[model samples]
Target: MRLKQGSLLWYLYLDKSYCLLSVRNVKALVEYFHLLDVHGKNTLNDVLFYHFLHHVTDLKKRQINLVFDMLDWSAVGEIGFEQFYVLVCILLAHQNHLEEQFMYRHSRTVFDLLDLKGDLRIGPKNFEMYRFLFNIQKQELKDLFRDFDITGDHRLNYQEFKLYTIVRINKLQKRQKKTEENAERERSLCSRKCRIK
Candidate 1:
């Protein structure tokens, strides 16, 4: 996967040397690098790389193995700091891109599957098929369909469905932000009380 230009990871990769130097704790990074170099060879062998990945990500064993295969481009059975940094940036960027692509593809696929008549809209008859795919209650489905239909035509078009998803995502993000702010405030209050005590 090509890294998107102007992305955070791409910028970091472009000036990795400067970024590394700007780190607040260069000693910690160097220590971490040595820890991953299990054989003390200033590089991570497959075993050390596996442990390093496990420490950094919650990826499954198979997924970690796949990453290992991809990053070991030199066929040298070991990885250096540069290779590790590049692989990390690429994977992070790839994951972000994949999430966006997946959401778009998934929505399109679901619309195609549910729009049985190929009429670019899902009507009552076609919506029956949607019930099998989604475990939503019938009344909830009706309410959602009504809300998403947008034109009040009693049918959901792809554009309308996409708009609904966008609105839902925005609302969810707002709620999540509010929740985080509340948690931070509580933490701040607790810390202040502890300091006072």
Candidate 2:
């Protein structure tokens, strides 16, 4: 239950004990985690670890909860390598991104999914995917620099580019989080209603 240094290495050996019905899903999750580890070398800082549930795959969470729900397995509310692997498997089995998208679009699913409203709280307006890379390149910046030149001078400095990138990422994250929260809230309400009814 407790994650330690040899966690991942140990899991590699132990996972063979359980027979998973869908091996492909397991492989996909494993690959996903591999990529995550590679890319998150720097991005997976202490902050990410502290909020590690965000990164966990659905499969992994169940395993952790079942095993370590009673124990303080995650000291900082974060799962380490072995715990991460278990969660990833659980995520693949239960967490359906497509389903989440559908629920968000059709109706806000829960507070953790998306917040369609302007409010930071979770709601339905958040799950719409309007952009494809091609659409972005074709429509939004068609002229690219038509209005970018503040003084009618056609050029962008390093500072301008840096600031733009920062602003863009922050905006996107905020919007996404809003949508996620909305969907999550909707889902929660639905479940509660179901239980009550």
Candidate 3:
């Protein structure tokens, strides 16, 4: 799969990491490494690496510095393939672990925003107040509320709301994956035709 610009693969590339060698395209990886090796030294200095982290990721300054230190294992202000590979593995694992926590906390935040009354449940009245926040019609909102209110209580508790949001996100992700697959297929066919010509 061709990694998107903001995906984890791109981050690894930005770090000039070799950890992605097993999973990413060789040509793309080589191009990315060359892009980061600005001084033609075949290595990333502190300044260049900092610029990479600053531009490619939204990580905080502390986190960026931590990653930089991790990659510069020898404290010589330069990183090699082994350091990059290890950093990539650590970052990927950390991100995967945080994803679930982030999703759960985000769902709670959304549910709290929707449940304005502090009643631990989102009823039609509270849901109506947030209608302007959504693009769906009133009827659609009602139907959604009904579907989310799994216990037939005419209200959605935090758990029900969280589940509903997760399901919705999963559905959207599936659709996005299907679209991306179709686009990749089209690109492959075009490339084949070009080669034939």
Q: Cα lDDT of all candidates, in order?
A: 0.59, 0.37, 0.59
TM-score list, all predictions? 0.42, 0.29, 0.44
Candidate 1 root-mean-square deviation in Å? 14.1
lDDT (C-alpha) at residue 70 in model 1 = 46
State the TM-score for model 3. 0.44
Q: Model 2 over residues 1-197: C-alpha lDDT tens digits?
A: 22333333223322222312245555654564555554454223334433344233222444334323312243444334555554333332222222222222222222222222324332111212211201224333333234332334443333332343344446556888999999999999999999999
Each candidate's number of clashing pairs is 0, 41, 0
Whole-model alpha-carbon lDDT for candidate 2? 0.37
lDDT of 3 by residue, 81-168 (tens): 5555444443442343322223333566546655655678988876665443233359866777878888898998888878866776
Model with the higher TM-score, candidate 1 or 2? 1
Can you list the residue pairs that collide in candidate 3? none
**Model 2 misplaced regions, further than 4 Å:** 1-135, 142-148
TM-score of structure candidate 2: 0.29
lDDT of 1 by residue, 120-183 (tens): 8878666554342233358756776777887888888899867755665466568779999999
How many steric overlaps does candidate 1 have? 0
> Runs in model 3 with CA error above 4 Å?
1-105, 134-140
Q: Which stretches of candidate 1 lie over 4 Å from their true place?
A: 1-105, 124-140
